[model samples]
Target: MVAIRIEFDDDEQYERLKKLKKHRGLTWKGLLLEGEKRVLEQTPE
Candidate 1:
């Protein structure tokens, strides 16, 4: 697996994502995996 650093243009967006993770009861790694899953699901096979 590759490590990546994603920067958000707005601090509110970053904070919102943090809140989402907390609300979903997911760790940082889990949040990343969930995001990856969503991306893959949206992509064409």
Candidate 2:
């Protein structure tokens, strides 16, 4: 698997994401892994 780094410039967006992570009780890595899993599930095989 390839790893990529992404940056977000909007402070509001960043804060919202932080809030989501806290609310969901997920670490950054866990949140990203969940996102990847969701994307893969939605894609056609």
Candidate 3:
């Protein structure tokens, strides 16, 4: 698996993601992967 890094300018947004990850019982990677998959599935081919 490939590793990636991202930065957030908004602390509130980062905090929200952290909360969501905990709420979903997922690691940061899992939450990002799930979000990526959902976005990809919704995008036009």
Residue-level lDDT of model 3, residues 1-45, one tens digit each, is 987888988999999999999999999889988999999999999
- Cα miss at 11, model 1 (Å)? 2.3
Model 2 pairs in collision? none
How well is each residue in 1-45 modelled by candidate 1, as lDDT tens digits?
988788898999999999999999998789999999999999999
Error of 3 at 23 (Å): 0.6
Candidate 2: regions farther than 4 A off: 1-5
Models sorted by TM-score, best on top:
2, 3, 1
- Predicted model with the maximum TM-score: 2
Over 1-45, each residue of candidate 2 has an lDDT whose tens digit, in order, gives 867786888999889988999999998888898899999999999
TM-score on alpha carbons, each prediction:
0.71, 0.80, 0.76
C-alpha root-mean-square deviation, each candidate: 2.1, 2.8, 1.6
What are the lDDT figures for the candidates, one per model?
A: 0.93, 0.89, 0.93
